[model samples]
Target: MALKEVISEFRLYVCNEWISKIPSHRFRNFYYRKVMGFNIGKDCSIHMHCSFDCAKNLIIGTNSVINSRCRLDNRGTISIGENVSVSQEVIILTADHDVDAADFAGRSIGVRIDDYVWIGTRATILAGVTVGKGALIAAGAMVTKDVIPYTIVAGVPAKVIKMRREDLTYDTKYRRLFQ
Candidate 1:
């Protein structure tokens, strides 16, 4: 294999197998910021058991909390804004294959989650989706398109259920002991 491919494989192994399993938040954040080149902001806590597709494409803002067992596919890019709360087992994808293409070629687009957004447990945010600020994604919702600001969405291929309160002032600064 090529040198670049080898290095990529090694990084993936270390991040998924070793770093994700580490109990200390400092250790994992240190590796992720310094070694993996992710742009993580202050007071951001990414819980254990979370995995990533790539390293450098993620940019997280301050005071955000990513819960455990979430899968972040940063093959394109993932821009998460401040005070965001990503619940457990949430899957955010930034890349997928185009089934309509003749060769089934791959396509990638960044996923953007605005400030004060709260994504519920097991929610799946698809590629190229832009979740608006103060929006709430219900549990198990499969978001396919852009969500409007201050709205509540639910169910598969998630549709707007209701308007959310515009005065969202909660800070998502959660730090669980030992992940």
Candidate 2:
């Protein structure tokens, strides 16, 4: 092998190690966002192993965290609001292919997560879905429809499971303790 190739590989290894050592909480203000054209807000955390496809179209608000191993297909403008938390292995797909079509490829719609929303572990927000402010989607829930504000949703198609109130302090405590 060429000496140049060996040096390139070594450089990649060093860069990867350097990135890995950084705290996961700094992604909200990451400098790489400018290169990718993504608009990231203050005090947010986007952990390692998460992939943003349409980085230019992604807008992350203040105090949000997109956790480890989560994949975001942001082709069509993804808007995430303040204090939103998405746990590990969650996939937010902003596009889809039509299975019934003969020459099918795909299409895009984008996703919106409003303020104070919490998406549990491994949850999927499908194309064209809107999660309203203060909504909570449970772990492993497949959200196909719009989640209403202050509602707690869970299931395959993610039906409404319960309600959350801003004044209610116990619900936050319950989710923190239980989930």
Candidate 3:
């Protein structure tokens, strides 16, 4: 690896191992913004034990709350819009291997979660998926495709269950004592 790449990797490891696990919201947010280069917005809260890869490619909008133990693989890009709530242990991945490729080459694509979305606990969102505005992903769902706006998806390889109300007006501004 190049010298710069090696240094960056080392820094990422250090931040993920120690800095990201810090419980203080102010400290974590400051580190994410000033050190890791994440584009986090106002009143955002990311709880402890959350993991992020390539933090520079992650962007979170205002009033968003990412609960504890979430893993975000931002190898490509992850753009989360305003007022979104990501529950505990959710994994948002942006890179994977192409099974059809001869060499099993790696592929990456951006994942976009639009405004006012609610992702339930332990849900897994794969690469190249755009979860539309006001969508809801149920617990333990594995999303491999795009989710339509104002819809609810559940189960493995997540299928659309029903539509949610378009009149959603909720802000996700949660603050914990040891976030």
Candidate that scores best on TM-score? 1
TM-score, every prediction: 0.98, 0.77, 0.97
lDDT of each residue in 1-179, candidate 3, tens digit only: 89989988887887789987787999999989988899999999999988888759989999999999999999989999999999999999999999999999999899999999999999999999999999999999999999999999999989999999999998899989977
Candidate 2, residues 44-68, lDDT tens digits: the string is: 6676656666436789887777777
Give me the runs in candidate 3 sitting further than 4 Å from their true place: none
In order of listing, the candidates' clash counts read: 0, 0, 0
Candidate ordering by lDDT (highest first): 1, 3, 2
Would you give me the overall lDDT of model 1?
0.95
- Candidate 2: stretches off by over 4 Å: 1-31, 168-179
**In lDDT terms, which candidate is top?**
1
lDDT winner between candidates 1 and 2: 1
Please list the C-alpha lDDT of all candidates, in the order they appear.
0.95, 0.75, 0.94
Q: Give the winner by lDDT: 1 or 3.
A: 1
The alpha-carbon deviation from the true structure for residue 113 of candidate 1, after best TM-score superposition, in angstroms, is: 0.2
